[model samples]
Target chain A: MLKVSVISPERTLFDGDATQVVAPAYDGEVGILTGHAPMMALLGRGTLRVTEAGGERRFTVEGGFLQVVDDHVRVVTEKAATS
Target chain B: MAKGRELKGRIKSVEGTRKITRTMEMVATSKLKRAQDRVVAARPYATSLAQVIADLYTPELAERFPLLRQPAATGPSGGRAAVLLLTSNRGLAGAFNSNLIREARSLIERLERSGAAVDVHVVGRKGIGYFRYTGRPLATQRTDIGDRPTAEHASELVQDVMRDFIARRLDAVYVVYAKFNSAISTPPVSEMVLPVTPPERKGPARDYILLPSAEAILSELLPLYVRNAVYRALVETVAGEQGARRTAMKNATDNAGDMLNILRRTYNRARQAQITQEIAEIVGGAEALKG
Candidate 1:
């Protein structure tokens, strides 16, 4: 499982374990799983999806960045809302 | 009779005032908690942004990004600076607004002495009124931001200033606000936010995959940093305002209580004296009748 945290300026949107995560990078969409190499990508405006053991959670995010170091994925967005 | 009545009236008024102050103190306490929570909520974004910027920033990137580059020298026009003064919208906050205004004034003076033309951007009614009354020029005045400031509000407050800084129209930008150290120790401070001083890189550099290019990312991140800085100042100022207000209202309530105590004592004394005189007069009249 990948440790994931979705943070906005107003509040922390999500923080838990996820099996897979996909985000809208500035250039394009990127997918991450456990043991993904260390990477940092600027986020654009789109829907971010995080897959857990039970189901998938979606967040509409805009203008921020994503960071993956080891198995920890941190998505810090300027704007995000549950969708 | 008149003396007793007047004392009673004074006591009643003092009690009313005490109730108001007590209520205000409670309101301020609750607002302070919310504002403090907001300050904590904003920390994650700020920390993450700082970490990313620190990781991506290099000394060489300064040449490419206008925000990162420090101007070598002031132009013949003499560098321009903007001071964003954050004050409270309402007045019952003890010396909160005044301290912030004073800090902003001194900062503007210092900037002028250093040969920079300073433009004042006043936030809140108190600061706007102070600047207007003093016949000082203000580039912008906003009273819409109340005790609760959102990220959008913060972005709106500093976006123009950031634009001017990037265009070299303004050499530096400073924010004057009460730094919320604690409920009791919030002091007004002025901090330079522009000319983005990248935090020193810590630990060994990680070979992470960069999105787009570092140059492009740094350019975008710099603006976000400025916005975050402004947002933080706004939130801290609000928290400090509530803190100051809570203290002020509590003191007012306490003073009112003490006044009520004194007034009630004086009223009782006057009533007792009146009753004693009435009894003495009746007794004297009865003695005269018997004679």
Candidate 2:
């Protein structure tokens, strides 16, 4: 499982273990699974989806930044909402 | 007798007002903390982005980029400009909304006198309503900024304005909003928004490799700069609103208390007068009987 933490300006929206994460980057949609390579992306306006074990969740994010390092995906977005 | 009754009604009204003001004060306090938290949390992100832009550019291109370029010699000063005015949707935020309107109106008037066609973009309900009511020209408005303003909400706004500028529709874009300095001090101000230019900063050299060309980076970075600027303004506006509301509510509460005190004094005076009149009548009758 990959660790994921999604934060907005006001509060921490999501923090848990996720199996995979799909985010809309500035260029395109980026899919991250466990043990993915370290990469940085400029987030864009779109839906961010996270799958944790059996349950899945989605959030609408504005623009910000995302980074993947050592099996962890850190998303620092300006705004986000569950979808 | 009527004055006494009026005092009674006034006392009740003032008491009711005190309750509302107290509630508002509490509410504004809570909202201010959240707004402040958002501002603080977003700071690091904004700083990093600025750092990236500073590093990602060659001194030549970054400085000479059209957007980064400074205002031209105003050359007879004949072009039209765009105004982005931000106000709160709801009232009771002190003079936060009105201050913005005042600045916008002044700027618009100045632009008009200078032969600059002004296109106005309003955010929040107060601005839209006030301008429309006064029959001022309005190009666009966002009324969805209620108590909580989100970046996603701001993104759409940023995109719309950028499209206009990029399309050569507006010559310049200025944002009018309240800048929060502290709990007690905030000033409604208009600032240049479009044509992102970081003030001249001299720092150590750091190399950056654009995945593509500098032109490619420029395309992406330009929009990002605009979006972030708008987002920061919105965040600051929200914080200022909360702070203004808190101060206004505190004043309201105090005024209500003063009114209540005045009413109570009148009530006591009226009661004493009635008592004195009764005693006078009784004593006069006793004196007449004695005579």
Candidate 3:
């Protein structure tokens, strides 16, 4: 499991452990599993999908940054809403 | 006695005043709760933004970003500074508006003394009126934004300030407002917002994949961060204003109630004195007639 936190300028959308996560980076889509390397990517306007124990959740995020360090991922965006 | 009648009238007037103040106190209390909720709602955004900045910031990159670089103090005297003052629309909120205005005025004066031309921008009716009455020039007077300030309003202000800053028309931007602490807030404070301060590194640096490049991402992020900062300031000021108003109205109501109580006691004493004099006269007249 990977600890993931999705935050928007208005509020926090999600913060929990997830099995897998996929986000739209500036160049293309990137996916993360449990042991992803520490890296930073610029986010473009697209849907961010996170797979938890229950099901996959999607959020539309725009113009932000995503960071992965020590199996923890943090996504910060200007505007985000559940898609 | 005539004094008794006068005291009765005073008590009635005090009662009316107390009713008005009590209602105001209740209204302020409700407003304060709403403002507090807004402050809470606004917190996550700011916290997240700061976290992202911290996570990505590098000392070398901080120097490259124009917004993160501090303005030179030894620059030419023709440089301009913008001051945005947040106040309330209405009065009777104790020193809420006045204190902010006074603090802003002093800041403006100080900026002028330092050879920077100051442009005052005011939000809310109270600030507009005070600046206008004092013959202080205003670059913008925005009274349309109501008690509940939205992110859009903050963005609008941000656009103008950023445009000026980018064009080198303004050297620095400052915000004057009451910092919200709780139900009670601190005195109005002047905070410099422009030439954004680079996030200090608090934790060990963990490398992240920079898309496009680090510079590209920072270029996009800095403006949004500034806008968020402005939005937080506005929300904080709104909460503080409500708090101040609530405290002021409560004091007014309590004082009025105390005055009414004192006046009622005085009226009762005067009535008793008059009644005692009438009984004494009756007893003395009866005794004289019997003799």
Top TM-score model: 1
The segments of candidate 3 whose C-alpha lies over 4 angstroms from its true place after superposition are: B73-76, B288-291
Q: When superposed on Cα atoms, how far off is each prediction in RMSD?
A: 1.6, 5.0, 2.2
Runs off by more than 4 Å, candidate 1: B75-77
Which candidate tops DockQ?
A: 1
Residue-by-residue lDDT tens digits, candidate 3, A22-81: 999888899999888877788988999999999999999987888787788888876789
Candidate 1 CA-lDDT value? 0.90
- Candidate 1: CAPRI quality band: high
Rank list by lDDT: 1, 3, 2
Where's the lowest-lDDT run of ten residues in candidate 3 chain B?
A: B69-78
DockQ for the candidates, in order? 0.82, 0.16, 0.61
Q: In candidate 1, what are the lDDT values of residues A1-83, reduced to their tens digit?
A: 99999999888899999999999999889999999998988999999999999999999999988999989999999999999
Chain B only, TM-score of each candidate:
0.95, 0.91, 0.95
Residue B214 displacement in candidate 3 (angstroms): 1.1
After TM-score superposition, what is the CA distance of residue A20 in candidate 2 from its true location, in Å? 17
What C-alpha lDDT values do all the predictions have?
0.90, 0.78, 0.85
lDDT of 1 by residue, B68-185 (tens): 6575556534688899999988998888888888888889888888788889999999999998899998999998888788889989988898888878898888899999999878
| lDDT string, candidate 2, B7-58, tens digits | 8988888899899999999999999998888877766556645655665566
Which of the numbered candidates is closest to the native, going by highest lDDT?
Answer: 1
